[model samples]
Target: MSQMLALAILILVLFIGEAVSIRTKAWIPSIFVSGVLFLLGFWTFFPPEIVTLAGIPPAVAVMLIYLLITNMGTLLSLQELKEQWKTILIAISGILGIVAALFGIGTLLFDFQTVVVAIPPLVGGLVSALIMSEGAAAAGLPTLAVFAIVIYVVQGFAGYPLTSIMLKKEGKNLLEKFRNNELTAKQLPGEQSGTTEKTVREPRMFAKMPEKYNTDFFKFFRLALVGYLAYLTSVLLTPVVGISPFVLCLLFGVIARSIGFLERHPLQKANGFGFAIMGLLLFIFDGLKNATPSMMVEIMYPLIGCIVIGVAGMYIFSLIVGKLLKVSKEMAFAVSLTALYGFPADYIITVEVINSLTKDEQEREVLTSHMLPPMLVAGFITVTIVSVILAGIFVGFL
Candidate 1:
């Protein structure tokens, strides 16, 4: 679709979603609305030109990728990254383990010719996966593109449903805690804040994240350094030593964060997120330009399947994890669901419910604070795993 048309459709969807949200007191989960938008975009704006060098299409795509990357990087402010160190470490382990296990399993089951080559980017994200997939195909794996998109579809949608079931109990407990008073910066009604004077102020001050930062060339340097290191390692290992790039990126991010290198730099945080995302989109779009209609359709099935699995898995598993974390029942639900679907769905659902129940600004901020990081991390992890698995499956060397 044309870029403006695509953006218009997205805005319209958001408007409709918000309108329905007001009416139903939650995000409108009606499948029909999404379907209509899908049709409108597909029929009217299925973009043309295979790698256009001079056109609005190419420029728009480039801008989209740039914005995406910048936003992702900007999210990584030093203090915020520091606060997330422990969880990020855990996420690294899980992401690596998942990518390895899923790749091995897919290879063993299908033993496809050379899908392993595409695995890194799929796990990394579409753009990264696209790079890996293209490299694989150039090396003789024709199905790489299909696999990368398949992974995206799976991780994108599957996370929603699965997290819902998993966090059911956690959600309940979080509600109770909200009713109680321990999980707050300051106590609410019928509670005393004699010692929580400072606690209450922290939430107000830290609730909003600053979006702007000073320009620093070093920040971009660190980001490029990480990317280059990961790229070099992935290229050498995948071709020579037989390793995956997805793991390479995760390792690089971890190392960058661990040594007080990237974390110590204020500007590097944003640069890191932005580059990762933008580079990824550039890669994915490039792949899309090369793909035929047949290839797109071929990948659609897995997209549907994987998304279902991701959503179902999260919903079913979040409750168990949420309980362990001791979050409230509803809050637990919110956490688990948001774990992978961090885009905005969780906020839509939880905020709707919270607003209906109470106008407590403090409560809303607390819930958002506790859940956002985990959700973002979960998205990164899930996307990576899904990418790798698809890569393995796509190459047919399995």
Candidate 2:
């Protein structure tokens, strides 16, 4: 279990994950697949030292996620959300449904510790997982800390197909509308008043770098510095305001982008930042290695119940909210499921769905432009923002 051996094993697993995902048309995300592979490898070959070696510093993960949120900020604009208020409100209602469901049904089926730990994954994303784990561990339920990560992993498997199917269906329906020349990006009432094409900017082919930063290396350094500063600010304010550092990081990212410190497409050019995220994700899997098969077996029944009940709650709530919001049930359901998958999964599924349904660039463009905003904004709302807040509160109760 030397460092080299651990790195090599991780590389091999990554390759296998990519191959399998390509072969299966990404019905399985490569990250989840790699995680399962790591689980097996850990059981078979990774000694304790190797498992330890597989992890990177937690700050690296924090900084990477901050950069990612910043990039997400660049992709969206408040003005654009004016046209997407229905989607946003529906997403919010969807989250409310999940919280209500957990308290309503979850209390009956699972004990208090299980119900509390379940809140993290139900809220969704890695940030929620880490926050809830820390909260649970602080409350002296160390075993429940592990449940946060386990539930995060379990949600992905339960969520993937449902998300995929919804996206595909939405794409198909949108494509048909395009063929009939009926699809248009409508500005729903209460959306901010503006021209159809507002001033929200896309990543330019050439980003203008600030003076003293001439190279891509320097540009990335500046972005990383912004993220680091944001993290530090969050730490300083957490005692006063009691918000998660990650949320502060996301806010700072949006602010930095607004002021022109970070580029619009940081992920495209920030190779180091991308590697940090990859390493951090690997670290998450390494944490999973700590959970032996026996540990998983103990919670399997409750885990299944969580997944089934959580997803069902989302769909049922979406139905009620969608009608109120004037969004179709299908779109509402797809967006609600973001509670389970979040981020790149939401982004990836949207792209894959559009690609599968249409070849015409114009049609694809129309669908993508419409579909992406809701998914992106919804993910930011549920996974990045509310989830962390909910985890913060729920952990205390536990």
Q: Estimate each model's TM-score.
A: 0.53, 0.82
Assess candidate 1 and give its lDDT: 0.44
lDDT, candidates in the order shown = 0.44, 0.71
**TM-score between model 2 and native:** 0.82
Native RMSD of candidate 1 (Å): 8.9
Writing each residue's lDDT as its tens digit, candidate 1 over 222-263 gives 555665676678787765664455445545555554443443
Q: Candidate 1 versus the native: TM-score?
A: 0.53
Q: For model 1, what is the error of residue 146's alpha carbon versus the real structure, in angstroms, after optimal superposition? A: 3.1
Model 2 misplaced regions, further than 4 Å: 2-5, 47-55, 134-143, 184-214, 258-261, 270-277, 355-364
Per-residue lDDT of candidate 2, residues 1-398 (tens digit): 56777777877787787677666665665666777787777677677455446555565555566667666665555455566688878887888887778779988988978888887677678777888888888889887888888888767767767776777777778778867888865443112356331343222222443434446676567666766776788778777886655655556655665565555556666555456546656655666666678878977888888778877777888889899877877788888888886776677667766765667878777787768878877877788778877887777787
